[model samples]
Target: MTPQQRRALDFIEQYYADRRIAPSLKEIAAHLGTKSRTRAHEAVAALVRDGHLVKTHGGRRNIAPAQIQLDRFTTAALRAELQRRETAHG
Candidate 1:
């Protein structure tokens, strides 16, 4: 996946973790600071097409991550990296 796509997925994952719900296209655009909601839509479409995400419940906050992506950081890896950065910066 491209970097932009990865960023969008990460934002989705974080959003799900924090809110216990999927974010909307607007939310995704806002979080990713994309040019527009249309870009967010395209990113989401790419994710769903590539099996990184799934839209469920006939289109609600049911957007969910699929089986773990192979080319991206696992949850633990992300936590470790975050901790490493915090420790370095702190």
Candidate 2:
């Protein structure tokens, strides 16, 4: 995923973990050091598009990781590929 998408995912995960609530577009923009909510919205949209996440509403909208239905082999391969990418990049 692109860095912005990753950051958006991180923000969603961290915020929910900390507060048990979803953050708004304004909050996302502020946390990412951007003044435009459009940019944050784009990032969030990418996450949703790539099947990495889903958005839900409970008064305010929230992002969460998508539920994967891959089999064990596919899941393992994906995990290994991610690890390989991380190791190579890091």
Candidate 3:
């Protein structure tokens, strides 16, 4: 994935961590410093395309992290990486 897309995913994950819920399109746009929700929606679409996140239903901010297919060892490693990054930058 591109850096911009990675950053958007990081932001989305952090938003979930911070708020204990998904962010709305407007919130995502504001967080990304974009001018419109359309851009935010686009970013979200990109993330979904890239398999980093998923949206539920068709209303509100019902987003969730995508499951990664990994062996147990790799899964632990990835979880550690996510935790480290979240703590370092979130």
On TM-score, the candidate that comes out on top is 1
> Which lDDT value does model 2 have at 40?
86
Native-vs-model 2 lDDT? 0.74
Residue-level lDDT tens digits of model 1 in 1-90: 998899999988877665547798888898888659999988889999999998778656668888644345567766876899999999
Where does candidate 1 stray beyond 4 Å? 68-90
Pairs clashing in candidate 3?
none
Error of 2 at 84 (Å): 39
lDDT of 3 by residue, 2-90 (tens): 76667777777766655546788888888778869998888889888877898777678878668533332355666777899999998
Span of 10 residues, lowest total lDDT, candidate 2 = 67-76
1-90 per-residue lDDT for model 2 (tens digits): 887777887777666545545678898898889999999889888888888778777556667657533332355666776899999999
Question: What order do you get sorting by TM-score, best first?
Answer: 1, 3, 2
> Would you give me the overall lDDT of model 1?
0.81
Task: For candidate 1, give the lDDT of residue 38.
Answer: 91
Candidate 3, residue 78: the lDDT equals: 68
